[model samples]
Target: MNKVKVLTVVLFIIAFIEVIAEYFRIIPLIYVFKPLISIVLMLLYWLSSTKKETLFFLTITTSLITNVLFIPNDLKFIFVGLIIFVFHRLINIYYILKVMKTKDFIPVVLASVPFLIVFFYIFFDTDLLTKEVYYIMIIHNSLISLLGGIALSHYIMNDSSRSSWLLICVLSFVTLHFIIFIEKFYIELQIFRPIAMSLNAFAYYAFYRFILIIERSNSN
Candidate 1:
């Protein structure tokens, strides 16, 4: 078989094995492998696709927001952040609905507002802000993950490249992060922690393979 096909088979095998291992509790690997798996999928997409370009700016922005949100906060900040995330989601849905015939770019601009609010609040309002060198690491890691998702969604959507890519990337990170964060917080709840992490990783790997298929199809 060809390289892409080999890769596809390999991912499926990995997923199958992971599920089996999880069922029997034979493996001791960290359960948080899902996000990393998602990142792997994204990297595969970027490497396989010949026509795509990296959305660096958007990745940076999303990463910064993630770091900011990681800051400790009371209910007040949580409420504000939730509101911002909701606004971002609403704008994203509106843009998705009109993505096909709408080339105006207004929707793209509108969609960015909520994200901007998120980043702004994290950067300016959070007391946990540290301008130390490590913040760069946080930014870098976040961007890589976000960019990976963006690349995957880009390959999946296959159209309306600008908006769908952004929306998916943001939403995926938010969804996965929240789930993982909650799971970590409840370490005693053995059912939710590692299992969710493994599933997240599997989901990410599946997505990565799917995008690889899409990239191969486009190349042909």
Candidate 2:
């Protein structure tokens, strides 16, 4: 517990440092703190969760890789990162499937509509998305939408702190990607970069909390 508590604090500090680095354009700090985040969160999960979820750890690994790919700020690298992120979302969805009580298709579809709209509007906006990237976005955004929809469905059906955390965790990912889209594709919103990092940190914490809650819920 002490370890978990300390790591959680460390996570916050890391987020603060990374965001400040991003905002100030501190290259060294950005390089150092950015990668440290998932490492720390993976440790927190290892210490906190009673049942070690290999799937979750895999998610962390892929997320770390994806984040690293995104650090270059190159569109090509980011496109590859999106490919990896599709896998990350797949792992999350699979994990959620194992834990969630039921699957409601209607809720999933209804919940995903907004995200799909945003994705399509952006990808189809200009000459940015070529034939290949357009197809990739279709597959990628579909999975992302499915991931968010499932999380939202879980939250709606189960009114509890666990579900709430789950929803927050997923939305943090969604929002971070939304900003990434805006910054990378639409326009350069410099502020959104730090905001995305902060959301990433909070998402890690929320995911940790959600796991604990769901594990306890299952045990009960």
Candidate 3:
């Protein structure tokens, strides 16, 4: 691979090390590497593409901000992070719609309904968040479900040989968010925390790969 791809691999290595260090309670290493994870992914995304460059840049930058804000465990910080994440989701929606197949529209919309019901149940029953924050969380969760549905639909409709990469990227995103929900409310077990962080890094790497694959297809 090229320089950007090499850099992407290096970033993933750094992220994996950071997560492992956190799991082992290596505080000094965690403090040094935790904040850099998103920055490295942002740069990786920025360096990896020419097509849809603006949208990809904005998406990763907003995600970086959201991740940074999430480092604080306060409700206020989480609320702000949710807002930023919502913006990022909106951008993702726009990008997905741009390449969406007409035939996939109804399928995508239908697929989102079940996810919406599940998230509504989770958010509505939770006593962890205040009323305002609860509503924000519901909205954020809904957007994530919608984005996943769109990505899934796109992957299904895409006929290209490498379309499976798109599906993998979407799955990584869904997994990352699902782990975030568990980490936020239920339990942050020792085993799961590192897995969550690994998922987060994988989500970014997979998205970068998805973009590269799409760019190559378009060029051909």
> Which candidate leads in lDDT?
2
Give the top-scoring candidate (TM-score). 2
lDDT of each: 0.42, 0.82, 0.73
- Of the two candidates 1 and 3, the one with more favorable TM-score, higher being better, is 3
Off by over 4 Å in 1: 19-172, 186-188, 206-220
Q: Per lDDT, what order, best first?
A: 2, 3, 1
Q: Tens-digit lDDT track for model 1 on 1-220?
A: 3665666565555555555554454444313322223343445555566644343222223322432342333445544444444443333334333322334444444444554455434444434433442354244334334333343444344554343434454455554544544443323344543454355444344433333344455567
Q: Lowest summed lDDT over 10 consecutive residues: which window, candidate 1?
A: 55-64
In the range 1-220, model 3's lDDT, one tens digit per residue, is 4977687777877898988886886767766676677677667665665664777778777887787676656788888888888899889777656644345468788767777777677666657777767777877888878877776666666655345665676677777777777777777777766887787777766777777776776788
Candidate 3 residue-wise lDDT at 25: 66
Q: Which is superior by lDDT, 1 or 3?
A: 3
Give RMSD to native, each candidate: 10.7, 1.7, 2.5
Give the C-alpha miss distance for residue 132 in model 1, angstroms: 13
How should the candidates be ordered by TM-score, best one leading? 2, 3, 1
